[model samples]
Target: MPLLTINLNPAVDTVCRVKSFNTHHVNRAYEVVKTAGGKGNNVARIARSAGEEVYSLCFLGGASGAWIAKQLTESGIYPVSVEVGEDTRTCIAVVDERDNSVTELLEPGPVISQEQQNRLLDKLLDLLRSKTFDCITLSGSLPKGLTNEWLDQLFAELCSHDIPFIVDTSDSRVLDLLHHKPTVIKPNVQELESWMGTAIREENDMIQAGYDLCRKGAKAAVVSRGEKGLLAIRKECIYKVSVPKVNPVSTVGAGDALVAGLALGFINQLPWPEILRKSAGFGTAATLSYTTGRIDSGSLPSLVNQVTIKKIQPV
Candidate 1:
């Protein structure tokens, strides 16, 4: 199955190690490493590593965006890109071993012109018309210039043709996209809490929220909780999956990994519980690796055994 990833707001991720972080203070960095990163870009990386054919569709503008395209090309991912007017964005994540928390600086992406947006969407639609994609994943946050109507617009195309889509996003936009009824949707605890517009203090609330989203039009809903693991609702059954203890270096891209795994599960037609295991497996595996969205596939096997499955009912 062909997997297509669309990154609307891409970036060059710069990582550095530091003893400590301080506000309004200059600090020396231990080392600097830059890589192609954006929520969608990282998801493509995960899908590629898992032995899937992926096409990375993104917009490149200025130097950083050019570097992103080059990185994708070198990594063996097919890049279908268009040049924009403004420069792409960059984010810096500083790892503080002393405090065990990373400090992040995020730059909002440059605004894209109307012509640029139309050109990109034209290509996407043209491709969809010509080829059969096993799955289309819309990952990451859309930049400011991208309108809220973007997801709905594509949803119309997919709904017209019955193409399955897996979406991982947050906030009001996510709710807005829910009306399109994507084939799969993944959200972490915090995102789910925000979506519910209420506190998710216990598992019952979490279960209800997942089911509620399914009722809201998601074909299947997967909710990820660090350590506590993943929850999913499909065909009127709720699967509660838990993972064994893990010492996480960071949790930044774990949810993305889960999205990739769930996408694989959907493509493979695995049973719901197996899908939960793999999703939890990949997510926990992501925590074992640091340096930004890089996952060690070797760790997945051991972690897979650590994943326990349970059938849950909401009260």
Candidate 2:
């Protein structure tokens, strides 16, 4: 079964390479690259690269949206988009190769209308009814005009459908959907800290926070700690994962790649340890590439070998 990824707010990501980026000064880029982006789209791209059949559902508007669709097609991800009135947003990422850092400037996407939001929801229901999918992933932030009440209803519908879902969004409102009990949730350290309303100062703090989230509704909570590695917490078990150090070209899409790996693992019904291993490998592999939301499939085997998974007592 294919993995369905939903991205309500999509963007054309422009990555510019500059030796040094100085604020308030004119800076020239040595190279420029653009690609389809958004957390869900990134998940789809990485999943496709990992040899999984993937479908991306998103809103497309104007020329920028059309370009994203074309790019997805070229990347072998089926784009299932709803046409919207406003042009899609563009995000800029300045990569400083000299320091191996990336600075991102993001734009709030086109404000969606009630009618457009309803249309997108309808399209999602239509697809869910028509196709057989292994899992569904809802990523990125909710666009404008999409309210908490609307999401509550939509999540209720998903619950009724009984489809396994993985949610990887930055929106705080996502916490409201936890009652529906998504199969898994991926949140970075900062996002997790915000949601849990506590400081994640160390591994044990993160593990406790993750488990607390599982207690609320999620079957599992995967907390990403950047280069520090990830902690996956379930009700009874916890897995601590660490990846071998590597020179990262860019860390832009590592989280999305991790989500993709976790989705694939869930689809295949792999053990939680294996899932953590795969997720860590995919996330680390993505760091080797300069492009956002991409990984070298060939490097996965070695990377997977380098991932260390330790089962710890649930905190």
Candidate 3:
């Protein structure tokens, strides 16, 4: 079964490496770079690179949107998209050489028309009806003008078919998805804190929150802690997964790859231990590269072998 990716909010990625970046100063700097990106698009790219068949569903418009479709197709991603009225959103990433700080300029996604949004949803369901998929991944933010009804209806379809879902989102919408019991949910440390409404100072507290999330309709929960490794709760147990330390060249898109790895593992029926290990390895490998949302396959296998996932009972 192929992996199906739904990207309601797509982006055009522009990255530049600036030396001694200064604000309010006309900075003469590195060459500007652009790439096809968005959370779901990146996940599909990583999943396909891992030797999985992927179908990408998104919204694109205008010349930039046309270029995005061109890039996705050229890169071998199957684009199932609908045309909208406005241009697609763009994000600018600046890498500071002095301290390796990356400043991000993210534009809110273009407002999707009601008709186009409905048609895209219809297209997604039609594709799902025509092809059976190993898993379904919903990544990134919901665009403006898309209502909760839209997401809820989509979740209903997933539930009716018993297709497992893995979602990466942060908002009140998450509270609604809980009723649908998504197969998996990945939240970073800060997002977890926001949901928990308390400071998570220690390992035990993190584990407690992971369990709470599972109890709240997530079949399995994974919380990513930068530089601290990942905490996973599944099979009525929690585990801490770590990898050989790498001085990360970039932190962008690491979480998306991590979720992709987890989704891929679930599709392959990999054991829980290996799934967690692969999740950590994919993330580490992604950061090993300097570019945003790019993970080289050559670095994954070796990194996978070095990751260790320890089964633990929270103290």
Candidate 4:
């Protein structure tokens, strides 16, 4: 079965390389690369690279949107695009080679009209009725003009279908939709801390937060800690995944790659340890490449093997 990914605020991502990257001085970029971007789109790309069929649903507008659609198609992902009036946004990331730092400039994206919002919902419902997907992933932030009520309604409708949902977003509004009980929620450590309104000072605190998310209606919570690897929390057990260190070229889309790996694992019914190991490997591999969302397929297996998974059974 194919996986379905939804990207509400997609963008054309431009990545530039700067040698030193001075704050007040004019910096020259030696290399520049552009690719189809957005959290959901990145998941689609990585999943497709792993030989899974993926369908990407998104709002597209103007020339940039058309280009993204074309690139997704060329990448072997089926695009289900809804047309809008405004052009899609562009995000720029400046990578400093000296210290491996990334500075990003993100646009607010287009304002989606009421009619467009309804059309997107209708399209999603129609697609659900027409095809069977292994899982549905809701990723990224909402664009302007989309309301919290609309998000609640979307979650309600999606839950009525009896399919599993994997949500990966930093938007705090997702806390409200947990009543609908999503299968999995992927949030970075910073995002989790923001949601909890407390700092995760220790491993125990992190584990407690994950369990708290479960009590709030999520079946499982996967917390991504950059460089430190991932922490997977479930009702019965918890997993701490550690990835092998590598010289990272870019950190863009690493979280999305981890989400993709989790989705793939769920789709294939793998054990929790293997699932987390693969997720850590995918995330680590993404950092080895300069392009956003792209991973080194050749090194994936070795990376997977290098991953260390520790499972803890909660008392």
Flag the better candidate by TM-score, 1 or 2.
2
1 or 2, which is superior by lDDT?
2
- Candidate 2 lDDT tens digits, 39-61: 88989988887788889989999
Estimate the lDDT of model 1. Answer: 0.79
Runs in model 4 deviating more than 4 A are none
Ten-residue segment with the worst summed lDDT in candidate 4?
Answer: 156-165
lDDT of 4: 0.90
Local accuracy of candidate 3 as per-residue lDDT tens digits, 1-315: 599988888889887888878999987657677877788988988888777888889999888888889988887789999998888899888878787778888888889877887898799889978999888988888888887788788777775666768888776477667767888888888888888888888888888887877777888888888777899886568888887788776788899889889888889989889888888889889887776557867878998998888888644
Find the 10 residues in a row with the least total lDDT in model 3: 170-179
On residues 222-262, what C-alpha lDDT tens digit does candidate 4 reach at each position?
99998999998999899888899988888988999998988
Candidates 3 and 4 compared by TM-score, better number: 4
List TM-scores for all candidates, in order.
0.93, 0.96, 0.95, 0.97
Off by over 4 Å in 3: none
Better of 1 and 3 by lDDT: 3
Whole-model lDDT, candidate 3? 0.83
The residue pairs in collision within model 2 are none
